[model samples]
Target: MNQPARVLRMSYLVASLAGVGFFVLSVAWLGVWPARRLAEDAKRTGPGHVVALTPSEARGRVIYAREGCAYCHTQQVRFTQADIARFGAPTLAWETRADTPHMMGTRRIGPDLARAGGTRSEDWHLTHLYAPRSVVPASVMPPYRHLFAGGSDAPRQEARDLVAYLETLGRARELAGDEGEARAATVSHTHMEGLTPSPVLNPHPARPRRTGEVPALPANGDRARGEWLYARNCAACHGSTLEGNGPGAGGLTPRPTNLAEHTYTDGRLAQALWNGVSGTAMPAWRDLPLADLGALVEYVRDPRITSQLRHDRTRPAQGELAFGQRVYEANCAQCHGAQGAGDGWAARALAVAPTNFRVQRLWGTAAMRILQTGIEGTMMASWRSRLSGEEMQAVAEYIVQLYRDEQDLRAREGRR
Candidate 1:
């Protein structure tokens, strides 16, 4: 038995066959087995209505894979406490039913993109893709400038396709709604118990906030600190001078608000800071601490910021008040509400909520211009075709008067 065989024998053949058999077993156990499991899960996903990719979305997925996007951002939301906290529920196997090769990466050099759909606006995506640092100053993401013809506004077909794919990241799960939550609970019970029950896909500041939740600010705020925060976070889209002409503003629809030209009530600032303006590119700053948010409020409400608007405002004559009221009731009340609190009968049906005139007042000229041109990328349409220039001016001024205080009821009828 110990003697070596010089010629090929049964033992030699047996050893070779065993080695080949083990190799096949490894491949079957590791690769093919897991892939089959994925396929099965895809078929029976909790969200039964998994949407197939459109041609554009498919093209975008190819571009995403080609760009090696998975290296930085992961599509998988693992069953961990940390992942669940920021990104809502853990990713379901069925959520990614359409993913062929799958983008469930292990590394998270950037945030997980499993719930990226509907978090940011398309224009925001375009600007960020064109130049990451412009929108997010601290972002380490390399610019995908080649995706655009010029700036972010001029996105190529490839860029549009990629964005379309991004918008579908968490669609199936969202569409599943309550059933998906129940499914998540059933499926995730084995991995971790006491999971957070969040209806929203992602709870991060990057998510566009549409809720009415607002945090109470401190009585006093540090203007200097607020200024610093504003410069870092807001200046990119709102402009250094708060003119809505920042480097990243080109891509945004309706553009960024001219912060300096808008007189914002404290409550308005709080709402904006906590929940962000719905239907626009403005994202909530809920990630910021209360103190930091307070500081920003102070900076925004600073006398310097409001000075230009206050002095430039030219209120309509007393005679125009009734005319303005009639004009507003006829055209604006259906969406903007009778009281201008952004809670009109048809407000819920709109993609973008009507502007709350009670909380935010714009300068007269800027208001008129907005009325003339209408706000692009929003439901606010031009009044140029419907109303005369004087009528627009009257309604705009009336809208400004709507921002008065509780004690200023004396001016409610423009008597003051």
Candidate 2:
């Protein structure tokens, strides 16, 4: 209001304007100006790989923005134990350095979407997006069916573009540099521990003589025997049709493999059935009687009614459910959970979570194998010496029953 006060106010306003203008100029210099200069430089530099954006990809980017996917799924991954433990590794600055208005999302309502490309086949992505409950029953994320035409056309051109964009999120150049060295070191460490090295181990040791030796097939090879064995032993996880959609499939990570798509020779199938696939959840069936093992193998190899022959359907006489319950409560409940959801008290501390008994596909193939070898690089210790073979067998049978009960409950709930 006064002359001196007005003069001071005018001076402050000028100074504030100058500061704001300088800040804007600094940002332009560091960000927009350099990026434009770099583009011009790259053009003159010649012959650099330039990714041409497809029409669908451009549209998908628009869709991503419109849907506010950035609100839930962060593109950036921080370098931390929790991040690396859940996801694979930390993000590199150069990976997103090329991005204009970079899609480094801030919120993390879902897992980071970086490196989502090729994580699973297209079919899995389609099924997952259509109904998250169908794949991961526990996922709280909402379905995105409206994105497709009438909620159909999953695996559409747009889906492919989205997947491609996700695949391009990681620092591919940096990963290629050190992946081999890291893998080699891991293999060396595993071998040093006297455990079977992973399948990726190169220049693998010579196959021992016992590797090729398979026991003889069962006499009077009954298809009925195989069916009964499967129902009692294998049906919990592999599903009744061996499609790998057993009632328990929903809870496991890395999910169950659909056996129908798998290609293996009769011998290889037999080997998998008998010895199990190393470095995975599959377990070796070394303890099953030689004839019973052969019968089960034949049944799985040729799962047709014509393969059926009569065999005993009798349950093991010594396996009382009451006794098995006692054993589970005493020894298994701490890690597998009281309800067998695989989230025991100790599960949170583990890098790879414990197995959910509700999913049979995880425990399919050889229950005995899991009891024999346990999981590798984790605390799932072998229980062969801790429990008697009969007790182990009883526990396996109980697990199968538990899977069936869960399936029945789910079906009943669905009807409601």
Candidate 3:
């Protein structure tokens, strides 16, 4: 039997009220709740205080967005093994709270930059910005010529502002230091609850260089292979002919080292290649094969090829060695070690290990220059204000004499 159907319908006022309630619930669930969660997370894990961007940094960020820098580079480090291996820990919920729209892009045409701060010096960033291909031969990024006054050396204000902003990327997290890192690690996730940072404990490899000794370099590397590698990797800042007068040298004060002017020990080359020269534009090349590094050592140490960046190799008198030792003990020993072994009391505290003079020797002219100007990035400061030029020469000579094998070094230098 077909019963008479009756339609049950709410009155207009009741229907309107129910629909409005549902809409409100949806908004609270989808929008307001997540925002509140993020705010609380920010308070917990963020660097103890909020830092507003400076005017320059703000402007740079605008430019960064306008230029679509975010399109290729991602700011977020996800909680995946590969991401952590390449880009440090996963980006915390609090890290980007200050970001207006967020620069966390999805694509990875370039490496993540959430922690790019202090990893590279300003010069490297500027050089990379002005002409990507100049420093990195395989870069696909287009040149930002408009940001420069002319060449890379002549960066406009906009360029500087952009770099300034980049420098602030991970500053807060790093400054929060160990306390903040601990806070971030406590974040509970389905996959990462109470676990450690990554599959490997190594830091990001885009690198300011690892401090301490480099591993043993390969012996008898092919010089031809090294020369080819140098042409590609080293010839830009260091001239094609090794003259230290590459087109980019105009921008760097204290300038790219004239590798050809001075002789280097095998150990010295190993340190420079492995750890990079501290406080200078020289960066680590540990990414290269050990064989490649050894080959480079061969070409660089070859006397015939050196002297392209000729400075007077005239050395101080042998009599200065005793005086030099005195100066070194009195003033240089605390950091360079009493015997120039780079194991001084303060050496471990420094970001870059002091040069191991036990194995590496700086020649006369080069040593004199390093004394007057100082190595900008390392603990080595210019002694010009404290020591007389003669005293500096004495100390420099003392360090040179500390070379592990004096006869081998003399033979390499072609001295009797």
Compute each candidate's TM-score over C-alphas.
Answer: 0.86, 0.39, 0.77
Candidate 2 worst ten-residue window by lDDT: 201-210
Candidates in order have lDDT scores of 0.82, 0.56, 0.77
- Top model number, lDDT: 1
* Tens-digit lDDT track of model 3 for 1-416: 23332222435667888899999998999889978887888787787686778999999999999999998999988877777767777888888877889999988898888988777777877888998877777789888989998877788999999999998888777777778777876664654754456632235543546466578888667989888888888888788877687766666644677777556678778778887765556777867888999998877776466554455445657677778888998998888898788888988888656777877666547878888988765678888999998898788777876778554757779964
- Candidate 2 lDDT tens digits, 283-332: 35654566666677657656653222323234544537667777787888
Worst 10 residues of 3 by lDDT: 1-10
TM-score: model 3 vs. ground truth: 0.77
Candidate 1, superposed: residue stretches over 4 Å from native? 1-45, 193-200, 303-306, 312-317, 406-416
Over 4 Å off, model 2: 1-52, 149-155, 171-243, 246-416
Whole-model lDDT for model 2 versus the true structure? 0.56
